[model samples]
Target: MFQKGDYTLEIKFQGDMTKKIVGVYRASYFDKLANETRYVVSTKFQPTDARRAFPCFDEPGFKSTFSLRVVRPRNLTCISNMPIHSEELNTPEPGYTTVFFEKSVPMVTYLAPQYVVVSSTHKYHIPLAKQAPNVEYAASIAPKMVEFYEDYFQVKYPLPKLDIIGIPEFISGAMEH
Candidate 1:
């Protein structure tokens, strides 16, 4: 490292798919009736896995806003930390689309980033009470919890929205980010 003035850094690179399902990996589900295999891509970056996904300071103390874009097959749906800002269809490649997400609030590298591309067949549905659906139950209680926390701390929730995702393959039990 040399001088420490102001600098603009741009990194362009591709990451290989992980077979063991860690730090941004592909997942597949097989449908017996349809006789097809559907694929989804998801990220699990906690502790230090974020560096494997992209170049960054990769530390909890280093905070920044994140603007994420993903290009994937048109049939899949992409979700990220922030809501979709805009989407560009059929550019650079056929049968693929680019999705741009809104800029996230200032947050640590670990908490500020997430991306998921799910197969169309893997639709999101609210779970029933009998199913012990943690995601659905969390969704129902998040708003109230946030409100209570804000009142207790005397501060508003920092982000425009709060997202809670359920990863069936998560290794750390659960992660705040």
Candidate 2:
């Protein structure tokens, strides 16, 4: 924690699932088989929760590009701020796969959110409601919204792809992330 002259740092750690649902927490859904439970892994890193997800410069002013990769069960679907760049089966760990996402635009850590959802139960839909739309719905409208904003501001959106995620339990009406 001394030198600061342009260096690459890497840190590895593990976190347990939290029932309280903060950053990188687990969510459970009841299955058709009565007592069976299915779990989904998700992240909520707005404000200051990004630290819980990983070791980073957590402040908003520290903008940086992010390349995210996730490894999970083959049946689960992974979504992040950027589109999927590549996906490959994890041969050593059967029934698992690794997904790599495109690098994000320079952004504060708080805006990055990642989700691993159950393929069978998770519903992906294009939202039509103005009040609150599902993630897929929000994502569907992002291009048009970006066009409007860019036209109004005379500036282009800096990201390759925009993503909108819907959280089951969110404190804010909608997070920019």
Candidate 3:
């Protein structure tokens, strides 16, 4: 939707267990544009498609504010739209995970990408995972999922914390969150 080198802010909102499960992801212009730039100098993205990249009503006229947090393992470094804010080690079963929370990005629902993953969930140290996934491949070929996505996305991750969770029941392969 945007070209690389272009800058855009995103505040993601999900209706998960938390009413406003939000995270701030950073987006930049890619050398390529999917359809057209909504804004001229800088676009105001409100995508109709599923990307919902950010938060928005898509009702034509609206204004909103947002907040974000990224969680992962302490040792596993994360990348967001911007640099990280804080990193906290958490245990209590979900130990091996780090809690990363960041500020908000400015964008529409359709255009914002609130969900991001720079690596595999097992990489973050899922002590309770029962069995840590052997990415022997995804890890060996590309040790850092964050770096892979950063290149794949053509945009830098735009938040403080980058959370990667593994869904054992997901399709036979890896799934991003």
Candidate 4:
């Protein structure tokens, strides 16, 4: 490499959406009411899986902010570490919509959140649509949890919002992310 005053790095790669339940995989659950199996795509980038999805300095100390954009079917919705900045409902591809998320706070590659494409009826926190009623209890208690943390830590929580998603199947009971 030659000496450089400024440089830009770009990497393009493709990864399969696998059924392994790890690192950008597809998941499915049977919907008895719907009388069919519904599928969703989600990510689990903990421990170093982020690199499997895209090129990155996949280390905790290598912190960086991320701006995410995702294109998905109109019937599906996406979620990530940050709140949505804006959305483009109309695109060249019919029946698809593009969503842009706010730039994330500087974070490690592992903590970096990934978006999931799930049914619009399934809200972020609870993926099992039939159990959507449980969302209210979590919503009611979350503010108290955050308030307790802030008081205990003696510092305000940093992020604009927090998403607590319940993947139908996950390897871990919980992730700090």
Please list the C-alpha lDDT of all candidates, in the order they appear: 0.75, 0.70, 0.40, 0.78
Residues 102-135, candidate 4: write the lDDT tens digits.
9988888877767778865555434357676677
Top lDDT: which candidate number?
4
**Every candidate's CA RMSD:** 3.2, 4.4, 15.7, 2.6
**In model 4, where is the ten-residue run with the lowest total lDDT?**
119-128
lDDT of 3 by residue, 40-158 (tens): 01112322422233334664244333444556554444443333556556742355554444555654443343334433233353333434455334455443767788899898765
Off by over 4 Å in 2: 1-5, 29-38, 121-141
Best by TM-score: 4
lDDT value, candidate 1, whole model: 0.75
Supply the global lDDT for candidate 2: 0.70
Q: How far is candidate 3 from the true structure (C-alpha RMSD, Å)?
A: 15.7
Worst 10-residue stretch by lDDT in candidate 1?
121-130
Q: For model 1, how does the per-residue alpha-carbon lDDT over 1-177 read when each residue is reduced to its tens digit?
A: 779797767889887668566678887766454577766688877777778788889888898888898998887887887888998999558888999899988887777558878766355632334545677688799999999999999999876666665544556765765
C-alpha RMSD in Å of predicted model 2 compared with the true structure: 4.4
Off by over 4 Å in 4: 1-6, 121-134
C-alpha lDDT of candidate 3 relative to the true structure:
0.40
At residue 56, candidate 4 shows an lDDT of: 89
